[model samples]
Target: MQTDSKWGIYEPEKACPNDWDLFQSYCYYFSVDESNWTDSKSSCQNQESMLAEVVSTEQLAFLTTKAGEYGSKFYFLGGSDIVTEGEWIWTTSRTNFTVTNWTPSAPSDDKGKENCLEMRKGAGYQWNDVHCDKNKTYICQRPLL
Candidate 1:
């Protein structure tokens, strides 16, 4: 539980790929659901949590797989730059990502509209710019103690 803070750029750990199977306390939600990203974030909040925040490759893999298990192609993470565009950071513990999964030429401050990120289907763990109002389910991670 060594959560560190950065100026703005989140510095996620190297990797923490998951070993998902049948039994696990993993959490997941929709990436491109009917609900907008904001709504999706709200949904997660209603559950007492916001969008998910993957700290390592293993956690990332677990989350991605959990989404797949729940029949979601992609899901919204707790990370975003809505308030501070270009300064995306996780909402939980302020954990940051050092290895971004954005696709080539992504996260562009397009006309100052796009502020959220979504995991692309069939794109491993890469993300793309998306609207916050767009409806989608977000995953929430509750690591075991």
Candidate 2:
């Protein structure tokens, strides 16, 4: 049986649209353009996807590596605590964060205004909370249909 070094059991690759990369059962799109959290989310929706949600350590590692390849300083994720401070959730799934890779001393909700999740280069590609209005590149993902 074929196996992926990182993911163990390998799954068959599915066709992803141009500029999208297939991983497991999903297609991921790494955007070059920058936009705020809300705009990024809308952009993904327009593309029939949602902001990339990192649900596991492996998923987070995949995204962090991809971000480096994309050469982006920061990328908006699907997580946000805008509705309730300190309670981050994946906006699309509306589920609480079960696995997180936050950088030490991060998600501080700096000045009580940082509510959006971002993978930041300065944070070693770990998760951090920043102002939702801050423009940044983003990643999007959708299931293989």
Candidate 3:
């Protein structure tokens, strides 16, 4: 077991890198800078992480709460449908969504150009699909070593 002054006790496998936040068995990094979805994904890759793959309702809630604390209006996540329209998948994990919290009437794929996923402020911090090229802050995640 390991002890963190602020977060209390955790197992060695739940240890996180400096400046990252630990939730469950994962470590998350909420970026301070903004970038397009592709660039954001690459950025996370460079950090030995991946754009956050929100796999559960609890995870989504945790992420959104952290986003609120970060005060960012939007944040890119790992979901996209660029390869197959309307078939969203976490780009890094290559896994289809088993849990979702999309805002009502969202992901309308407005103008057939919205393909990247974001947690949006206007949507009460719910998921929304937007253009992949749009720049936004991002969240990255990796399993704790």
Candidate 4:
């Protein structure tokens, strides 16, 4: 059997770089460099991946555990309501986000200015709505192919 992902179809037996971490059915790269959401996405794109998408609490937990070592900082996620505020969607996955781990009172949209989604270490890696222009570290992910 085969599976289809945002990156199209691929086999799962292949390996990612020795430096990259493999979790579940995907390969992840946690970037230490800080950049605005757009630049972060671009950086991931250059690496043939996209800003990490939180598909499940288990995956989010894995990312959070790895992220803690890098220090507390916001990390761009693959979600945004930039197209229409309040309508969040994963830009890379092109699917409506069915699950999320947000801190209490989050996604407030902050005066209706925030459109991008980021994971805040201080909030225990819960999702936070932020301005797309805010500079932050980021994570990238691709199917394990």
Candidate 5:
């Protein structure tokens, strides 16, 4: 079976490369300290990356857990409503991934006129909708080989 140790991820042997290869998949992790929804998305694009598009169940769990390490310091994910209300989709793609990390009763309406998606560092770092103007840290990622 593929092992997390092989990539020095389980124990984090050191400051691993931003582009970490795991289970035949390349994972690049980047973060922005703070930015508005649009700005955050733009930043990732400028970096040739987009707000992380988590593709698998394991990947979503891993990312959500890691986000909690920051403790109440919310962070944005790749999902947004830049196109239309109630049409939440990952910034990297048009359709939502099969696995989602949103908490129960979350994303309640486009209330607060939220145009952004941020993670709440609790209960497995689940997701919550927030105003696009709210400042918070964010993650951006891209596949690498």
Candidate 6:
């Protein structure tokens, strides 16, 4: 993969497909329109991909920059507590949360209705928990193929 010296920005390589941005060993798709969490997840699946999984702080930063490039207000993450409250997991990777990059007073689950994760522009692209039904732009990811 043609990545930067810091491995932050990944340029398209011979193996990379069109319309997908390469980052490390993964390819990501950022949606242009807003959709709810469930529908967003479905969209990714339809594209033979899954909602993005932020595996580390570095990856989170990289994702934050990607989301900003789309100029969207918010972007849905692959994490949710729909299965079990307060227990977030990447639906695609089936990985449990270890470290999160929340802005401040985030993941608040205000009024106890929040269950889905999103990176918000207002919060400097930090992850936040919001109601799953709320519409937002989303990111889809899949292994480099």
Best by TM-score: 3
- Location of the lowest summed lDDT over 10 successive residues in candidate 3: 5-14
Candidate 5 pairs with clashing backbones: none
lDDT of 6 by residue, 51-144 (tens): 9988877778789898788789999989988787778888777889876887788778777689999999988888899999999999999888
For model 1, state the Cα shift of residue 80 in Å: 0.8
Q: Model-by-model lDDT, in order?
A: 0.63, 0.90, 0.92, 0.87, 0.69, 0.86
Q: What are the RMSDs of all candidates, in order?
A: 11.2, 6.6, 5.1, 6.3, 7.1, 6.7
Per-residue lDDT over 1-145 for candidate 5, one digit per residue giving the tens place of the 0 to 100 score: 3348667554323332554323325454546368887788888788776777767887876776666644547878888776888777876788764667777977776554876788777646777788888877777776553
Q: How close is candidate 2 to the true structure, as a TM-score?
A: 0.88
Off by over 4 Å in 5: 1-24, 30-32, 70-72, 110-112
The TM-scores of all predictions, comma-separated, are: 0.67, 0.88, 0.89, 0.86, 0.73, 0.85
lDDT of 6 at 69: 83
Runs of candidate 2 exceeding 4 Å displacement: 1-13
- Local lDDT at 86 for model 1: 82
lDDT of 2 by residue, 48-109 (tens): 99999888778877888888888799999999998887888999999999889899988898
lDDT of 3 by residue, 1-145 (tens): 6667687867464479998999999999999999999999999999999999988889988998999998899999999999999999999889999999899988899877999999998777899999999999999999888
Candidate 5 or 3, higher TM-score = 3
Model 2 scores a C-alpha lDDT of 0.90
lDDT of 4 by residue, 1-145 (tens): 3467776776565788666899988999888789999999999999899999887879978999988876648889899998877899999878889889878988999888898998898898888999989899999998888
After superposition, candidate 1 runs with Cα above 4 Å error: 1-33, 143-145
